[model samples]
Structure formats: C-alpha cells, structure tokens
Target chain A: MLEITDIVTSYGKIEALKGVSLSVAPGKITCLLGPNGAGKTTTMMTVAGLLKPRRGNIAFEERNITGRDPGHIVQSGIALVPENRLVFPDMTVHDNLRTGAYSRSDDEIEDDIARMFERFPRLHERQEQHAGTLSGGEQQMLAVARALMARPKLLLMDEPSLGLAPLIVEEIFRIIRDLNAEGTSIFLVEQNVHQALKVAHYFYLLEQGRVTFGGSPGDLEEDEVIQRAYLGSAEQT
Target chain B: MEFVDYLQAVTDGVMQGAYYALIGIGFTLIFGVMNKINLAYAAAAFGGAYASLGVAALIGTGDDFGLPPLIMFLVSAIAAGLFAWIVYTICFRFTPDHYELATLMATVGAFFLIEEIAVHSTAGEPMDFPEVLQGIVDDPMIEFSDAFAIRGDLLTIFLLALIAMGLLLMLLYRTKLGLATRAVAQQRTAAQLCGISVDRTNATTFIIAGVLGGLAGAMIGAAVGVLSPLLFVPLTVKGLIVTVIGGLGSIPGAIVAGLLVGGLENVFLALRGITERDMYVMLLLFLFLAFRPQGLFGKKAVRD
Candidate 1:
C-alpha cells in the first residue's frame, strides 16, 4: 500500500505537481487518469524517487520513502515501468532483464528471468536481440517483463498503453489483470479511460497538478465532471 | 623511400599506437559512462606519471634495496585514479545533468587547473623516466632485416599495454560493475529506475578510466624515456582524436582507430616532414566528420 499526502514537485521555475494527494491500496489495480500535461507522470516519478517533493511526504506500507534515492526506493520493493518503456536500446533483451534485477544478488535471478521468458514467449524468441530493434509492442512487453524481474511488492506503471495498437493494448490490460491476480499491487497511469475503468478497482482523476477526483468506477459514472471530461470520450470511442 | 623504410615506420607507429590506445580507452570509458568529455583526463594522467617519477627519484629504481618497477605503475595508477576522483568531484558531481555544456566547461577549467598544478610542481622541466629492459645492444632490438627492427623497450611497453587492455576488457564484459556501467551508459533514467546507483557507477567509471590513464602515462613515459608537462597537451589532443575516430563510446573502436592514427601519423611523417604530419591526421578527422561521423565501430544514433 502507498499513501501520497499533498506532495508538491517542480522543475526549475515551474510547479508540475502542486499539493497533490492520492492513495493506492494493496492487492488492487489502482489507476490514475488524466489528459496530457496533467502531472500524471510527475506523480509517478515523485513516488518512484526520480523527482523530489518540495512539500508533504510519501509512505509505502507506513515507511517514509519521500526524497530517497531511486536505488533505495527500488530496494524497498517498488518497481516502475517508466513512461515510454525506456528499455536500454543498445542492450540485449536478456541483459535488459538482468539489469532489472541489478539490486538483487540472489541465486534465483536466472530462474526469475526464465519465468519472465515463459510469461512473455515473444521475449524468449528474441532474448539475444537488441531491445531497440524490437517492435513497439514487443518493447512494451519487454519493459513490463524487465520491471517484473525486480519482484517488487508494488509495481508503478506510467502510460503502459501509450501509442500502442488496440489489440496490443488489450493484451497489456490482460497482463495487468493477471499481475493483479498474482498479488502484485499496481498503480497505473492511463489515458485510455474506458479500458482503465474496466480493470481499475479504484481510480483518481488528476488535472493541472492536483487530484480532482477519486472514487470507484461506479462513482465515476455518477460524477458530472467525469461524465463530460473522461467518460464522454470513452462513450464516443 | 624504400619499402623497408615504410614497413619500419608502420611497425614503430603500431608500437606507439599501443600507448594511444591506452589513453583513448580511458577517454572512451569516461565518455561511455557520463556521455561527456573530460578535458582534464590527460593532465590527470601526467600528474600521476609525475608523481611516480617523484617516487622513483626518492626511492631509486637502480639498486637491490630500491623500488621495484611494478610499484611505479601502481603508484601512477592509484595517483591518477585519485586525480580523476578530484576531477569528477569538481567537474561532474555538482554540475546539472541536463546542461552538458556546464560539465564541459568545468572540465576545461579542470584541465588548465591540473596542468597548472603539474607545471608549478615540476617547474616545467623534463625528468628522466626509468626504462624497462635497460641493458641491451642498441637497447635490445628485434631485427626483421637490417632495415626493420623493434626497440626492446617499446616492445615491452606495447606488451604491457596489451595485457592492460585484455584485463580491462575482462573487467567490462565479465563483471556486475561493468553491467551496471553499461546499463547506465545506455539509459541513465532506466538504469536508475532499475535501482542502480548512477552516481556510484559514474564515479567508479571515472576511477577506472583514471587507472587506464595512469597506465598510459607510464607507457608514454617509458617509451619516450622522459616525463614532462609539455607532453600533456599533445597527448590530450591525440587521445581525443583517437576517441572520435574510434567512435565516441566504443572500446574496440578506440583500439583500432588508435592504431590507424598512429600508423598514419608515422607514415605521413616519413612522407612529409613533422609539421605536415599532423596536417594529414587532421585532414583524416575532417573527412571522417564529413562522411562517417560515427567513426569506425560507433553505433548509429541511440534511441531513447
């Protein structure tokens, strides 16, 4: 479980996340939905320790993790599939997965890599190929598999389905559901509201560096702002 | 010009290329990790070499109770690594990451700062460097005909460089640190996201390159039989030339390009005079920039 309380993060002169607050319960697929430049990625980055907050704090399972180094945060059992699936392009798929397990010196690394290959068969077929040469869908799958290699208690994914084809997006969602079923808590940031609403047990809408709304999908349908801003587009699609 | 003379020129050039390869490897390694050039690298290396000379002068390399030849290398390497750490702290650690120019300027400042330090300490005077294989007819030469021969001292330095290069490759390809380094080089954000301490990795990379620079400094000193601050600038320029022609971040590229540049420099020296020799090498670099900017063995533009 993770709790973010009124955290403010900024670039040089501009505030990207201003007093934003949210929570992700354990064993659930919690989704953050917002339009472009709504600070969705900023929230993910701040929680992942890529960005430092100027105000407030973040607690992971009651442990303060605010402003820690990314290494410490990852070691605390949180893994992030960053926006754009930033897999090391020059590295082979196998090495990429190996790097995912960089913090762990356990004997089961190869075993976990094998398990990742089993789950993503396409990855097994191209394990030795450079990740940059893989297709966009394949790269996304590799990114997910790489994050999973960390064996984190909590998984943070930012825009996993961005720029993905419809069929591939569906497959990604299926994997998200399967991962949640396996007891890995997921805090996902998504723009595809209709698909996200289907899988997310609880959701929050982020707009302009603030959390505008938070509720179950059922409550989403009843909210007027959600009806016009998000579901309106989902229904049209 | 005789065919044997040309062959001799190339052979000597290749031997000298070993030192260039060592220096260029240091340059490429630093570039690979931080994606920024350290202009102070050669100065750090010369500083190490000069420190070793001071050690040699104090302890003596001539008698039964004297310092072993191996200590000289160790002193140079450790000293260079220390200087590199200082360079990292001053030039790289505090500078903002996104603005690469700041780091670049910082390193340029470091170059002059370090060079000035070395100059003040040594008083801009050249000192004799201890030679390997000290006693031999013609200082020991391997004859391939009367016209072509390899100087024993240079051959020893070349072989030592070869061994150093072999160990470096093993460290890079067969270790966890190397894996983290490569990951950081490929994607800094992704590497951090994977829980790698990018700062530690970058710092370690600087030290590793520094060690290589020290070895190169020792080699250059041994081959020339002298150590001087004046050699720093020319060596720095040559090292950069090697890095670019080898590609920015490729180790194998550095080796191959080092040899190529070395061989070409000598062949030009043999064809023209010393002044025109560098002109050809510069022209070669310009041609590479105009045509294959990536250099031999360099990867095409990296994807985000």
Candidate 2:
C-alpha cells in the first residue's frame, strides 16, 4: 500500500503537483486519469524517487520514503514502468532484463530471468538482440517485465498504453488485472478511461494540478462530468 | 629506393598506431560512459610511464628485482588507474548536474595541472625508458624488406597494444560490470531506475580507461625509449584527434582513427620533417571537423 499526502512537486519555479493527496489500496488496481499536463506522470516520477517534492510525505507500507534516491526506493520494493517505456536501447533484451534486477543481490536472479522469459516469450525469442530493435508493444512488455524483475510489492505504471494499438491496449489492461489478481498492488496512470475503468476498482480524476474526482468505478461511471469527458454520453442528463 | 623508404615509414607508423589506438580508446570509453571529456587521460599516461621510471630507478639492478621493466610497467599502469580515479573524484565527482562545459573546462585545467606537476618533478628533462623483453632477438624483425624492420623494443610495444585492445574488448562484453556500463551509456535515467548508480559506474569506467592509458604509456615510453615533459601536450592532442576521427563515443571508430592518425603522423614526418608533422595532423582534424563533424563512426545522440 502507498499513500501520498499534500505533495507539491516542481520544475524550477513552476509547480507540477499542487498539494496532491491520494492513496492506493493494497492489492487493488487504482487508476489515475487526467488530461496531459495534469501532473500525472510527475506524480508517478515523484513517487518513484526520480524527482524530489517541495512538500509532501510519501509512505510505502507505512514507512516514509519521500526524497529517497531511486535506488533506495527500488530496494524498498517499488518499481516504475516509466512513461514511454524507457528500456536501454543499446542493451540486448536479456541485458535489459538483467539491468532491471540491478539492485537485487539474491541468488534467484538467473531464475527470475527464466521466469520473465516464460512470461514474455517474445522477449526470450529475441533475448540476444538489442532492445532498440523491439517493436513498440514488445518494448512495453520489456519495460513491464524489467520492472517486475525487481520483485516489487508496489508497481507504478505510468501511461502504459499511450500510443499503443487497441489490441495491445486490451492486452495491457488484461495484464494489469491479472497482476492485481495475483496480489501485486498496481497504481496505474492512464488516459484510456474506458479500459482503465474495466480494470480499476478505484479511480481518481485529476485536472490541472489537482484531483477533481475520486471514487469507486461504479460511482465514476455515473458521474456527469467524467462520463462527458470520457464517454460520449452523460448519464446524469 | 624511394618506394622502400615510404614502405618503411608506413610500417613504423602502423606499429606506433597500436599505442595511438589505445589512447583513443581511453578517450572514447570515458566520453561514451560519462559524456565527460577527460583531458587528464594522456597526461595520466605520461604520469604512469614516469612513475614506472621511478620504480625502475628504485630497483637499481638488484637480483631480487625480478624483471624490473615488467614490474615497472605494471606499477606505472596501476598508478595511472588510481590517478584516473583521483581525477574523477576531484575534477568530476562533486560537480553539479548537467554542467557539460564546466566539466570539460575542469578536465582541461587538470590537463595543465598534471603536466606542470610532471614538468616540475622531472625538471622538464627526458629520461631513458628501460626496454621490456629486450636482447632476445639477434637482430630486428624484417617484415618484407631490409628497410621495413622493427627493433625488439618497438616490437614489444606493438604486441602490447594488441593485447590491451583484446583485454579491453573482453572486459566490456563479457563482464557483469560491462552490462551496467552499457546500460548507463544507453540511458542514464533508465539505468538509475534499474538501481545502477550512475556515479559508481562512471568511476569504474575511468579506472578501466586509466589502466588502458597506463599500458599505452608503457608501450609509448618503450617505443620512444625516452620519457619527457614535452610528450605531454602532443599525446593529449593525438588522443583527442583520434577520438574525433574514430567518431565520438564509438569504440571501433577510436581504433580506426588511432591507426590512421599514427600512420599519417609518420608519413608526414618522413615527408615534411618534425616541425611540420603536427601541422598536418592539426589540419586533418580541421578537415574532419568541417567535412564530417560526426567523425568516421558517429552514432546519433541518445534520445530520452
């Protein structure tokens, strides 16, 4: 479980996240939906320890983890599937996966690679090839598998389906649901409201630099503004 | 007779090219991993050679010294590697984020600072470099003609160059540390997310490149059979030129560029003499800058 409270993150003088507070329930798929520049990716990056917040307390499993280094946060059991799936382009698929487990000093590292191969067969097929050569969908898969290589309790996925095809989007959502079903807590930042609603038990709508709405998926579906913004029809009307 | 002379010059150039390539590789590795130009690199090479000379002098022909030149070479290389780590800590480690020009300027300062130290220490005088594996051959090596022969000392330098390159390739491709290094070079942020400390990886790279520079310095010292403060600026210039010709951040490019620069330097010296030799090399660098700024093997800058 992860809780972010009154967090304000910035780029120089411009504030990207303005006193934002949200909670991701344990073992649940909590989706954060917002328009571009709504600080969605900024929130994920801040939580991942890539950016330091000007004011905030981020607690994972009830221990404060804000302002920690990305490496420390990773070792604390949080892994990020970053926006645009930033896999190391020049490294081989196997090497990319190996790099994902860079923090882990366990004996099961090789076994984890074997497990990742089984989970992502396409990755295993092109294990020796550079990750730059992978298709967009496959690269996304590598990013997810790479993050999972850390064996994190909390997985932060930022815009995993951006620019992906509809079928691939469906595959991604299905994987998110399956992951949640297996008790891996997911905090997903998505633009695909309908697909996100399909998987997310809880949803939060962010607008500008603030959270505009937060509720269960059933409550979200019935809201007028959300329905109009996401679906063509407004249920309230 | 003229053709034979040209052939001999080319052969000599190629042999020395091996050492040039090693220095180029140093520049390439440091730049590729850290995106920081190490101007201290060649100076560190000279420093290593000088340090080895000191070790040899300390040994003073004792029977227990046990292959004095070989031990001297190893000490020189290890010292150079440590010197590189020192350069990284002082010149680069504490520098603030994203100051590429600042780091470059700092390393440039280090270049002069190190050269001055060597100059002061040795009083700007050339010292004799002991030969490695000498006196075994009855005569020099004859490749084809009497004009194209290599002396035993120069032959050791050539062989050492090839060995350094082979070991470098193995260290980069066949080790776990190499994987982290390649990841960092490809994508710094992503590598960080994977929990690889960018700073540690970069420091490790400097040590590796520094050791390579040491080997190169040893071979260079052996080839010239003399070490001098005068060699400092010229070696640094050659390394940079090789880096440019090889293509920025490309290992293979550095190798090819090193050989090209080495061979051309000799041919130019043979034709136009020492005073004009470096003038031509500088001109070649200018041509590459104007015509192919990316060098011979430039890869596009990595996008985030």
Candidate 3:
C-alpha cells in the first residue's frame, strides 16, 4: 500500500504539484486519469522518488519513504516503468532486463529473467536485439516486463500507452489487468479513460495538481459532470 | 623514404596511437556516463606516472618493502583511482546538481592542482621511470634494413593495447556491471528505479577510467624514458580532441580516432613541422563540430 499526503513539488519557478494527495491500496490497480498538463506524470515521478517533494509525506506499507533516494525507494520494493517507455536504447533487450534487477544480489536473477521471458514471449524473441530497434508495442512490452524483473511490490507506470497502436494499447491494458489479477499493485497513469476504467478498481481524476474526483468506476461513469469533463464528446453517446 | 624507414614510422605511429587510444577511451567513457568532461584525467595519469616512478626508485634502492613491477603497476593504478575519486568528490560531487559548467570548471581546477603538485614534487624536472619489461624486451633486434629498425617497447605497447581493448570489450559485453553502467548512462532515473546506486556507479566508472589512464601514463613514460608534468596539459588536450573527433560516447570511435589523430600528427610533423601540426588537428576538430557534431558514432542529444 502507498499513501501520499499534501505533497508539493516544484521545478525552479514552476510549481508542478501543489498540495496534491492520494492513496493506493495493496493488490489493486489504481488509475489516475487527467488530460494533458494536469501534473499526472509529476505525481507518479514524485512518488517514485525521482523528484523530491517540497512538503508532505509519502509512505509505503506504513513506512515513510518521502525524501528517500530513488535507489533506496526501489530497494524497498517499488519499481517505476517511466513515461514514453524509456528503455535504454543502446542496450540489448536481455541487458535491459538484467538492469531491472540491479539491486538484487540473489542468484536467481537469471531464473527471474526467464520467467519474464515466459510472461512475454515477444521479449524472448527479441532478447538480443537492441531495445531501440524494437517496434513501439514491443518496446512498451519490454519496458513493463523489464520492471517486473525487479520483483516489485508496487509497480508505477506512467503513460504506458502514450504512443502505441490501438491493438498494442489493448494488449497493454490486458497485461495490466493480468498483472493486477496476479496480485501486484499497480499505479497506472493513463489518458485512455475507457480502457483505464475497465482495469482500474479505483480511479482518481487529477486536475491542475489536485485530485478533483475520486471514486469507483461506477460512480465516475454515473457522475454527469465528471463524465463530461473526462470523456468530452464521447459522453453525449 | 625507404620501405624499411616507412615501416618503422608506421610501427611507431601505431604504438603511439595505442597510447592515445587508451587516454581517449578514458575521456570518452567519463563523458558517456556522467556527461561531464574530466579535464583532470591527464593530470591523474601524470600523477600515476609519478607514483610508478617513485615505486620504481624505492625498489631499485633495494627497499625490502617494495613491490614487483606488475604489482607496482597495480599499485599505481589503485593510487590513481583513489586520486581520481578524491578529485571527483572534492571538485564535482559536492557542487550544485546539474550545473555542468560549474563541474567542468571544478575539474579544470583539479587538473591545475594535480599538475602543480607534480611540478612542485619533481622540481619541474623530468624523471626516468623504471622499465617493467627491461633489456629482455626493450629493444629486441628487429632490423628491416640498414636505415630502419623497430624497438621492442613499441611492440609491447601495441600488444598491451590490443589485450586491454579485448578485455574492455569482454567486460562491457559480458558483465552485469557493464549492463548497469550503460543503463545508468542512458537513463539515470530508470536505473535508480531498478535499484542501481547512481553515485556508486559513477564512482566505479571514474575508477575504471583512472585505471586505464594510469596504464596509459606508465606506457608513455616507459616509451619516452622520461616523465614530466609539462606533458599533462598537451596530453589532456590531445585526448579531448580525439574524444570529440571520435564521438562523445562511442568506444570504438575513440580507438579509431586516436589512431587517426596519432598517425596524422606524425605525418604532418614529418612534412610541415610541429608548429603547424596542431593547427591542422584543431581544424579537423572544428570541421567535425561544424559538419557532424555527433562525430562518427555518437547519437544526437535528445531533448526531453
């Protein structure tokens, strides 16, 4: 479980997150949805310890993790699949997977890698190819699979479907659902509202660095203003 | 020129190129991983040369506490690595984050500090370093003709570089540490999320570079038979020129560029003179920057 309380993050003169707050229960796919420039990515980055918060606390399983180094945060069992599927472009797919377990000293890393290959057969096929040379869908799959190599208690994914094709997006959503079903907690930041809602057990709408709406999918779908706000023209149908 | 004379020049150039490659690789590796040019690397190399010479002197004096040549080399390497770590910690680490200009200035300052230390210690005089591979291999009779010959030192340097390159390639391609290092270089944030400590990785990278530089400095000192602090600045400049011409982050590029620069510099010196040789090299660097800023193999910088 992860808890964030009144966190503010800034980038020099620009204040990115102003007093934002949220919570993620264990073993659930919690979706944070917002339009562009809504600070959704900032929230995920802050939680992952890539960016320090100016104020407030972030805790994992009741342990305060706010201001901890990113490596320490990861060692504590959180892994982030960053935005844009930022795989190490020059590294081979196999090398990228190994990097995901950089903190683990255990001998079963190869076994874990094999397990990830089993989970995503496509990754196995392109195991030796440079990750940059992969297709967008394949690269996204590699990114997610690479993060799973960390054996993370919590997976933070930022816009996993940003530039993928529709079919690839569906496959990614299916993988997210399957991952949640297998009992790994996911904090998914997505723009694809319909697909995110289908997989997300709980949803929050972030607007200008604040949580504007928080409820179950049913509640979100029923609320006329919330539906109009997120779905736009799709809501008329 | 005679065929044998031409051959001798080519052989010498190739050996010199290997030393240049060693230094150039150090420059490129640090730039690749940290995005900071360690202008102090050549100073670190000079410091290692002095340490090697010091060890050699102590051993020659029949000091029972002295180490063998190979162990002395290792000691020199470790000493250089520790010096580099200290320089990085003092100059770059504690500085404000992401201020690359400030870091560059700090490294340049460290470079002067080390160079001054070497000058003060040696009283601005050149010191002869003890040869590890002495009369046994220093000048094996390789006679091509009456006018041309080759020394065993050149051959040794060339072979050593080949072995170093082979090992470096293997370490990079076959090791988990290399994987993590590449990951950190590519994406520090993602690497950290995978539990790689950025600071530790960076320190290890610097140490590796320092070791390479130490070996290079020892080779140069052995070949020239004299080590001077005055060589540091020019070596640093030449190494940086090679790094830029090769590419900012490409390993193979550095090796190729190093040889090209070394060979051409000699050829120019043979034709025009030493005074004008550096002008041509600088011109080449300018042309590369103007036409192909990424060099032969570097990727274009991607904006986030």
By TM-score, the best candidate is 1
The docking category that best describes candidate 1 is high
Question: Which candidate number has the best lDDT?
Answer: 1
Candidate 1 colliding pairs: none
Higher-TM-score candidate of 1 and 3 = 1
lDDT of 3 by residue, A1-237 (tens): 899999999998788888888899899999898767778899988988889999999999999999898888888888888998888888889999988888788999999999989989999999999998899899999999888888898999999999999999999999998898898999999887878888888888877677777888888553543454354334223
- Candidate 1 local Cα displacement, residue A45, angstroms: 0.1
Q: What DockQ does predicted model 3 obtain?
A: 0.75
- Tell me how much of the true interface, by contacts, candidate 3 captures: 0.83
Q: Relative to the unseen true structure, what is the C-alpha lDDT of residue B200 in candidate 2, on a scale of 0 to 100?
A: 95
**lDDT by residue (tens digit), candidate 1, B1-304:** 9999999989888888988998899999999988899999988998888888777777764543144445677788899999999999999999998899999999899988888887888787887776766543454788777888988877887888889889988887788888899999999999999999989999999999998899889878877878888898899999999999999999999999888898889999999989899889889989988899999989877655
Question: For every model in order, what is the iRMS?
Answer: 0.6, 0.8, 1.2
Error of 2 at B85 (Å): 1.3
Worst 10 residues of 1 chain B by lDDT: B61-70
